[model samples]
Target chain A: SAVISQKPSRDICQRGTSLTIQCQVDSQVTMMFWYRQQPGQSLTLIATANQGSEATYESGFVIDKFPISRPNLTFSTLTVSNMSPEDSSIYLCSVDNGAFFGQGTRLTVV
Target chain B: DQQVKQNSPSLSVQEGRISILNCDYTNSMFDYFLWYKKYPAEGPTFLISISSIKDKNEDGRFTVFLNKSAKHLSLHIVPSQPGDSAVYFCAAIGSNYKLTFGKGTLLTVNP
Candidate 1:
């Protein structure tokens, strides 16, 4: 079992601003995943961050809006750029192929 | 297309009773299924999992039943307690290893 620590447990940001969420794993992992859960919606996979490589994003999401960086196996960061009201959602980071998850960062964009 | 479906939005059960939650999937490629429990202001926590080749898996008070032929699955909790009250999510993983989740069902185990 791996433990993940996510920063900024909750944040309220102004529209048009960007917020970066950081995820740190207790153990080194080859791949880490980012997810989003909007109000009253299911958890959606945003992107898969691979160590030493570019992150693979899912459909309906783009890199410019959610840029990811995985500098090492144990750490990664996701930046939500040009935020809007629609971007208000809970963001989470996962490891161990989805078995373990960080507490998640709840972002409210106004 | 919603590959995973949890038809019931919410369920209420008295404490110490049996609480059953159902889930269905449209994608045949999914080979692994998992259930997660989530409290408000927290991430979903892994509860139990079942493989496509298995029909059932049990862990203490929780059991997951898989019916591959019906493309359905369910989670059963015996002697449900108030602490179990939370949003439950059904997730599936295919060859791609990415989890497809269903809209969660809020379970309220009344004391």
Candidate 2:
């Protein structure tokens, strides 16, 4: 069981702007991931944050749109670029030690 | 095509009864399955997990039964309580280390 701290518990952002969500783990984890849960939908993988390297984005998601930074093993950040109403969702960061999730950032692009 | 599926949108169960939640997966490559419980304004918490090698795994009041032939799994909670009311999500992990999640089912335990 890993303790993950995610920032910006809830935020209301304007359209066309970007919001960065940070995830910090209590210990070093080999694999970290970002997820999105839209209203009335399931959690979708956004990307895998790699240590000392670029993040891996899933299909329908681009690095430019959701640029990720994984500076070290215990910390990572996800930026939702050019937001819109459709981007309104709960963004979560997870550490894959049999899977543990952060509290998640609830973002509403108005 | 969604790999994991939880068809029931919501369920209402009386307290002290059994609460069963079902999940199905289309991908055979998934070797591990997990259940997560989520309350409003909180992150999804890891509830229980089962490996494909076993048919059933039990943890206190919660038990997860897996049927590989049917590609389905179910979670059973005995003596449901008001605190059990929350959305439950089914997630599967394959060799790739990516977890695919199903649409969650909200459970309402009526007192």
Candidate 3:
């Protein structure tokens, strides 16, 4: 199983501000998944980050609001632009190898 | 609409007993299903997985049963332990490695 490290484990930001969460995998993976878990809700797929291409976003997610970057196999970043109170949630990155997930970044927009 | 659904929000089981968690999916294209356990302030960890080809798959004390016709799947943990208390999530794998998850069921095992 691969280990994932996520930065900014928790953050508090003002409305309209932006925050970028980083995920680093111990081993190179072909596909990295980003998910959001709202308060008392299930995990929702944000996008799939693939190296050397534009990420594929889910139906409710857009590239402009939640831009994703996969510079390489072991690294990816998710940026929450113009965040609002509803954007407060836990963001996680995962790899399919036994579906390992990072500790997660808990963002709170005030 | 949610592709996967877990109707029960929580479940309680006695230690040394069997714990059954259920999940249902509306999508017919899903070919793989997985179970994950999550603790507070942490990401989910994979528990077990079952492909659509098999009806049942077992590992140690954990077993997963899938019903293709019913579009339902269940995870059974025998002789449940206190450490097993956590939020359990069920996921269905779709195209391009996309996973649709159900609202998790929090399982509490009491000794």
lDDT of 2: 0.94
lDDT of 1 at B96: 91
Each prediction's TM-score versus the true structure: 0.98, 0.97, 0.95
TM-score of chain A of each: 0.99, 0.97, 0.97
Better of 1 and 2 by lDDT: 1
TM-score of chain A of 1: 0.99
Off by over 4 Å in 1: none
Predicted complex 2: CAPRI docking category:
medium
Task: Please list the residue runs of candidate 2 whose C-alpha ends up more than 4 Å from where it truly belongs after superposition.
Answer: none
Candidate 3: C-alpha RMSD to true structure equals: 1.4
Residue pair clashes in candidate 1:
none
Model 2, residue A39: what's the lDDT?
96
Model 3 chain A: weakest 10-residue lDDT segment is: A91-100
DockQ of 1: 0.79
